[model samples]
Target: MRELELKYGCNPNQKPARIYMDEGELPITVLNGKPGYINFMDALNSWQLVKALKKATGLPAAASFKHVSPAGAALGTPLTEVEKQIYFADGFDTSPIACAYIKARGADRLCSYGDWAALSDVCDEATARFLAMEVSDGIIAPGYTDEALAILKTKKKGNYNVVQIDPNYEPAPIETRHIYGITFQQGYNNFEINESLLDNIVTENKELPEAARHDLLLALLTLKYTQSNSVCYVKNGQTIGVGAGQQSRIHCTRLAGSKADNWMLRQHPKVLGLQFVDNIRRPNRDNAIDVYISDEYEDVLAEGVWQETFKVKPEPLTREEKKAWIAQMHGVSVGSDAFFPFGDNVERARKSGVEYIAQPGGSIRDDNVIETCNKYGIVMAFTGMRLFHH
Candidate 1:
């Protein structure tokens, strides 16, 4: 079918919504529920992200997307025992793709609520089962196994959006969009992110390890699809934090760095040992944990609100403890859609244990930025390519 009508556009009043191909049949089939305009937007953009990730890493990849930006993305790296526990995936046989989704969603659980999921490989039963347990709006993949499809079809009262795209389908080189009755066109961003782009080390410390190269590649690819003025922090094989659509470059860095700090704090012994009342929902637990880690935990404790989520009055994760915990984070890789204009971005990133960086390197204050990285012994690369997405 060339055209698929939608219930509405981005909003209920934006009527007469649909997606269609101008020349050929559409590449996707809606195997389950009808997806709206925003859902399809998230699905298509997220699909491209995972596709590029798998091609670059030679592993299965997954992404969690919200409002056309990725909340998290990752390759299929094996989960450690601590990772499995923190991600709430304690027991169950899992496949590579399943592990990818788990890590992707776990990167920022609060942001991934009601997210759209995308996978580089076909959906297997294990992956579907894991997806079923999450709070998600829909999913898109090349294909699905029978058991996987059956399980997904049962979610959201059989109204979950399940999209299947042809793996071989490719769009034209030129892409177009419209806003306010005007047309805007551009060549699709086909820039491939790999180790080659990260070879231009400009910092005093020029040592870039193989693992750091992979993480930098992951960060850059994620930023490519992220909204402009964005920064991403990646470690191991997954994105730990992504700050998208910020106006200032420093704000982006600080926002993403704080998120990275939160991701690290979740693994702290204190956070991991928080006792909750029996049968508390995952979302509630997530919110409670977030509050517990923030500075407002003392206020929550004083207000006696902790009784609703935790079994006992938990000790506040003091400011000193959080600082000490974040200091231990290291080898983090950060990528920017554009250049950093000041050294403050570097200062904030270093607090979150960022030791490697990649940016376009066109700012007037490049000397200052490089000097800041040198002081911290951070290795930075000037990719000289801007990756701004809307």
Candidate 2:
């Protein structure tokens, strides 16, 4: 179809919304449900992200997007037992694509609620079964198997939005948009992210191991599609944290670092052993886990909130325990969408176990940033290319 009508624009009060191509049919077909403008925005942007990840890593890729920013993104890597439990993959058939999607959504379960999912590979039954259990808005992929399509059709009371994009389709180099009756145009961002960008090591530690390089590349690719003023933290092929659209670079670093710290804290034995009430909803369990990992867990437990989620009132993860667990977190890789103007960003990232970093490196305080990395023995590279997505 040349154009697809939508119920409304970004908000329901807005009127007359549709998407069309000037000279050719749209590259996507809406297999089910009427997706709104924001859904399509998320779908298209997330599609590009997973596609690039697969190309860069030669592995299946997936992304969880909320409001055009990815909550998480990851390549298909076998899930460890702890990973499988925390990600809710236990007892489910774990295909490569399924593992990628699980890890992506698992990166930040709180932010992934009602997310738009994107997969690099065709949706198979294995992936569909897992998506069926999550709270999501819709999904986009190159294609879907017959059984997978049938399963997805049952989600969201049979009104879930499912889109299939042509894998071979490419947009024109120049892109345009309209705002307040004014036209804006620019060449599409086609800068490729690969291992080559990590060549310029700027720290005392010049060793960029193969696994660290892969993590760095994954972080950079994720930042490429994330909102500007963003930072992403990656480990073991999946994004552990992403802070997007923050005004201050330090804020972005701290926000992402906090999320990374939480990811590590969840793997603690106490957290893994928490027993939720029978049939507790996935979202509720996720909420409980978040609160349990935070400093407020003691307060919440005193208020008797655990009765709602857990069968037994679990002991709170103490501040000291959280600190010790986070200290053990190492080998993380971080990427920035733009240059870091201060070394403080590096210092904050180091607290979250960041051992490798990738940034454009155009800051006036480059020496200071390099010095900070040296203090931590962190390996950092100046990619010389900013990935500022709107």
RMSD of each: 0.8, 0.7
Q: Give lDDT per model, in order.
A: 0.94, 0.94
Write one digit per residue (lDDT tens) for candidate 1, span 274-381: 999999998899899999999999998999999899898998899999999999999999999999999999999998999999998999999999999999999999
Clashing pairs in 2: none
The clash count for each model shown is 0, 0
TM-score of each: 0.99, 0.99
- Write out the backbone clash pairs for model 1: none
Error of 2 at 366 (Å): 0.2
lDDT of 1: 0.94
Candidate 1 weakest ten by summed lDDT: 85-94
